[model samples]
Target: MSSDMNKDWPLYEVFIRSKNGLDHKHVGSLHAADATMAIENARDVYTRRMEGNSIWVVESKYITASDPSAQDPFFDPAEDKIYRHPTFYELPEELTHM
Candidate 1:
Protein backbone atom coordinates (compact mmCIF):
# COMPACT_ATOMS: atom_id res chain seq x y z
CA MET A 1 0.00 0.00 0.00
CA SER A 2 1.08 3.60 -0.59
CA SER A 3 2.36 5.59 2.37
CA ASP A 4 -0.55 8.03 2.03
CA MET A 5 -3.07 5.18 2.31
CA ASN A 6 -1.24 3.62 5.24
CA LYS A 7 -0.89 6.87 7.16
CA ASP A 8 -3.29 7.46 10.04
CA TRP A 9 -5.89 9.92 8.75
CA PRO A 10 -8.30 10.79 11.57
CA LEU A 11 -9.99 9.01 14.42
CA TYR A 12 -13.62 8.00 13.94
CA GLU A 13 -16.15 6.74 16.44
CA VAL A 14 -18.49 4.05 15.23
CA PHE A 15 -22.10 3.45 16.14
CA ILE A 16 -24.24 0.59 14.92
CA ARG A 17 -27.99 0.07 14.96
CA SER A 18 -29.25 -3.47 14.61
CA LYS A 19 -32.22 -4.50 12.56
CA ASN A 20 -35.48 -3.26 14.13
CA GLY A 21 -33.50 -1.26 16.66
CA LEU A 22 -34.45 2.26 17.68
CA ASP A 23 -31.08 3.61 18.81
CA HIS A 24 -27.48 3.27 17.69
CA LYS A 25 -24.91 2.16 20.22
CA HIS A 26 -21.21 2.93 20.11
CA VAL A 27 -19.25 -0.05 18.88
CA GLY A 28 -15.63 1.02 18.43
CA SER A 29 -13.18 3.40 16.78
CA LEU A 30 -11.01 3.43 13.69
CA HIS A 31 -9.02 5.77 11.46
CA ALA A 32 -10.02 6.90 7.99
CA ALA A 33 -9.34 9.69 5.54
CA ASP A 34 -12.91 11.08 5.51
CA ALA A 35 -16.52 10.54 6.49
CA THR A 36 -17.18 8.33 3.47
CA MET A 37 -14.20 6.13 4.24
CA ALA A 38 -15.09 6.10 7.92
CA ILE A 39 -18.51 4.64 7.22
CA GLU A 40 -17.12 2.09 4.82
CA ASN A 41 -14.38 1.03 7.22
CA ALA A 42 -16.77 0.89 10.15
CA ARG A 43 -19.08 -1.42 8.20
CA ASP A 44 -16.32 -3.77 7.12
CA VAL A 45 -14.62 -3.85 10.50
CA TYR A 46 -17.58 -3.82 12.87
CA THR A 47 -20.45 -5.29 10.87
CA ARG A 48 -18.84 -8.22 9.13
CA ARG A 49 -21.43 -10.49 10.71
CA MET A 50 -24.25 -8.44 9.17
CA GLU A 51 -25.24 -7.38 12.67
CA GLY A 52 -26.11 -3.80 11.85
CA ASN A 53 -28.95 -2.31 9.85
CA SER A 54 -27.55 1.19 10.03
CA ILE A 55 -24.10 2.58 10.79
CA TRP A 56 -22.95 5.99 12.00
CA VAL A 57 -19.36 7.13 11.86
CA VAL A 58 -18.43 10.38 13.56
CA GLU A 59 -15.03 12.01 13.51
CA SER A 60 -13.61 12.00 17.02
CA LYS A 61 -12.81 15.70 16.81
CA TYR A 62 -16.45 16.66 16.32
CA ILE A 63 -17.79 15.00 19.45
CA THR A 64 -18.37 17.29 22.43
CA ALA A 65 -18.73 15.42 25.69
CA SER A 66 -19.71 16.67 29.09
CA ASP A 67 -17.09 16.68 31.80
CA PRO A 68 -17.53 13.63 33.98
CA SER A 69 -16.29 15.45 37.10
CA ALA A 70 -19.08 18.06 36.71
CA GLN A 71 -21.84 15.49 36.82
CA ASP A 72 -23.37 16.84 40.03
CA PRO A 73 -23.74 20.38 38.73
CA PHE A 74 -24.56 19.32 35.18
CA PHE A 75 -27.40 16.97 36.13
CA ASP A 76 -28.64 18.67 39.31
CA PRO A 77 -31.14 20.82 37.44
CA ALA A 78 -33.07 17.82 36.19
CA GLU A 79 -33.43 16.39 39.68
CA ASP A 80 -35.19 19.53 40.87
CA LYS A 81 -37.52 19.48 37.88
CA ILE A 82 -39.82 16.75 39.15
CA TYR A 83 -42.62 17.91 36.89
CA ARG A 84 -40.75 16.40 33.97
CA HIS A 85 -41.43 12.92 35.28
CA PRO A 86 -44.58 11.10 34.20
CA THR A 87 -45.35 9.95 37.74
CA PHE A 88 -45.37 13.57 38.92
CA TYR A 89 -48.72 14.16 37.22
CA GLU A 90 -51.89 12.24 37.95
CA LEU A 91 -53.92 11.58 34.83
CA PRO A 92 -57.65 11.49 35.19
CA GLU A 93 -59.32 8.03 35.00
CA GLU A 94 -60.98 9.15 31.74
CA LEU A 95 -57.57 9.46 30.08
CA THR A 96 -56.54 5.85 29.67
CA HIS A 97 -54.04 6.56 26.93
CA MET A 98 -51.77 8.46 29.31
Candidate 2:
Protein backbone atom coordinates (compact mmCIF):
# COMPACT_ATOMS: atom_id res chain seq x y z
CA MET A 1 0.00 0.00 0.00
CA SER A 2 1.05 3.56 -0.56
CA SER A 3 2.42 5.54 2.38
CA ASP A 4 -0.63 7.77 2.36
CA MET A 5 -2.94 4.78 2.44
CA ASN A 6 -0.94 3.27 5.27
CA LYS A 7 -1.29 6.52 7.21
CA ASP A 8 -5.05 6.31 6.80
CA TRP A 9 -5.13 3.13 8.82
CA PRO A 10 -5.86 3.81 12.49
CA LEU A 11 -2.84 3.81 14.75
CA TYR A 12 -3.13 1.35 17.60
CA GLU A 13 -1.17 1.25 20.85
CA VAL A 14 -0.68 -2.24 22.15
CA PHE A 15 -0.38 -3.36 25.76
CA ILE A 16 0.32 -6.85 26.98
CA ARG A 17 -0.04 -8.35 30.43
CA SER A 18 2.11 -11.36 31.07
CA LYS A 19 0.90 -14.29 33.17
CA ASN A 20 3.18 -13.11 35.96
CA GLY A 21 2.52 -9.41 35.53
CA LEU A 22 -0.02 -7.44 37.55
CA ASP A 23 -0.32 -4.64 35.01
CA HIS A 24 -0.30 -4.26 31.27
CA LYS A 25 2.81 -2.75 29.76
CA HIS A 26 2.76 -0.79 26.55
CA VAL A 27 4.65 -2.94 24.09
CA GLY A 28 4.31 -1.15 20.77
CA SER A 29 2.16 0.54 18.15
CA LEU A 30 0.66 -0.72 14.90
CA HIS A 31 -1.69 0.27 12.16
CA ALA A 32 -4.87 -1.68 11.58
CA ALA A 33 -8.23 -1.31 9.89
CA ASP A 34 -10.13 -1.76 13.15
CA ALA A 35 -10.00 -2.89 16.79
CA THR A 36 -10.44 -6.58 16.04
CA MET A 37 -7.69 -6.52 13.47
CA ALA A 38 -5.49 -4.54 15.82
CA ILE A 39 -5.84 -7.10 18.60
CA GLU A 40 -5.24 -10.01 16.23
CA ASN A 41 -2.20 -8.32 14.76
CA ALA A 42 -0.85 -7.50 18.22
CA ARG A 43 -1.19 -11.10 19.37
CA ASP A 44 0.51 -12.46 16.26
CA VAL A 45 3.31 -9.93 16.35
CA TYR A 46 3.96 -9.42 20.07
CA THR A 47 2.77 -12.56 21.77
CA ARG A 48 3.93 -15.19 19.30
CA ARG A 49 6.04 -16.65 22.13
CA MET A 50 2.87 -17.07 24.23
CA GLU A 51 4.30 -14.73 26.85
CA GLY A 52 1.22 -12.59 27.40
CA ASN A 53 -1.93 -13.58 29.24
CA SER A 54 -3.91 -10.55 28.09
CA ILE A 55 -3.76 -7.92 25.39
CA TRP A 56 -5.18 -4.43 24.91
CA VAL A 57 -5.36 -2.39 21.73
CA VAL A 58 -6.36 1.27 21.91
CA GLU A 59 -6.54 3.69 19.08
CA SER A 60 -3.78 6.25 19.51
CA LYS A 61 -6.11 9.16 18.87
CA TYR A 62 -8.29 8.37 21.91
CA ILE A 63 -5.54 8.28 24.48
CA THR A 64 -5.07 11.24 26.78
CA ALA A 65 -1.60 11.70 28.26
CA SER A 66 0.21 14.07 30.49
CA ASP A 67 2.88 16.24 28.99
CA PRO A 68 6.36 15.21 30.14
CA SER A 69 7.61 18.75 29.68
CA ALA A 70 5.03 20.03 32.22
CA GLN A 71 5.99 17.51 34.87
CA ASP A 72 7.36 20.04 37.35
CA PRO A 73 4.27 22.22 37.69
CA PHE A 74 1.85 19.43 36.91
CA PHE A 75 3.04 17.20 39.73
CA ASP A 76 4.60 19.67 42.16
CA PRO A 77 1.46 20.03 44.29
CA ALA A 78 1.57 16.34 45.20
CA GLU A 79 5.08 16.76 46.59
CA ASP A 80 3.76 19.01 49.37
CA LYS A 81 1.31 16.32 50.45
CA ILE A 82 3.81 14.58 52.68
CA TYR A 83 1.20 12.21 54.12
CA ARG A 84 1.03 10.54 50.76
CA HIS A 85 4.52 9.22 51.34
CA PRO A 86 5.00 6.06 53.39
CA THR A 87 7.80 7.44 55.53
CA PHE A 88 5.93 7.40 58.88
CA TYR A 89 6.43 3.71 59.54
CA GLU A 90 9.71 2.63 61.03
CA LEU A 91 11.05 -0.72 59.89
CA PRO A 92 13.40 -2.94 61.85
CA GLU A 93 17.00 -2.75 60.81
CA GLU A 94 16.97 -6.49 60.25
CA LEU A 95 14.47 -6.06 57.38
CA THR A 96 16.58 -5.48 54.30
CA HIS A 97 13.89 -5.08 51.68
CA MET A 98 12.35 -1.87 53.05
Q: Pick the candidate with the highest TM-score.
A: 2
> lDDT by residue for model 1 over 2-70, one digit each (tens)?
567646687899999987647999999988999999999998999999878999999998999999999
**RMSD (Å) of each candidate, 1 decimal:** 4.3, 3.0
Query: How far in Å is the alpha carbon of 61 misplaced in model 2?
Result: 1.0
* Reference-based lDDT, residue 97, model 1: 65
Candidate 1 residue pairs in clash (backbone atoms < 3 Å)? none
Would you list the clashing residue pairs of candidate 2?
none
lDDT of 1 at 50: 84
The alpha-carbon deviation from the true structure for residue 41 of candidate 1, after best TM-score superposition, in angstroms, is 1.5
> Per-residue alpha-carbon lDDT of model 2 for 52-84, expressed as tens digits?
999999999999999999999999989889999
Q: Candidate 2, TM-score vs. the true structure?
A: 0.75
Q: State TM-scores per candidate.
A: 0.68, 0.75
Taken over the whole model, the C-alpha lDDT of each candidate is 0.88, 0.92
Candidate 2 worst ten-residue window by lDDT: 16-25
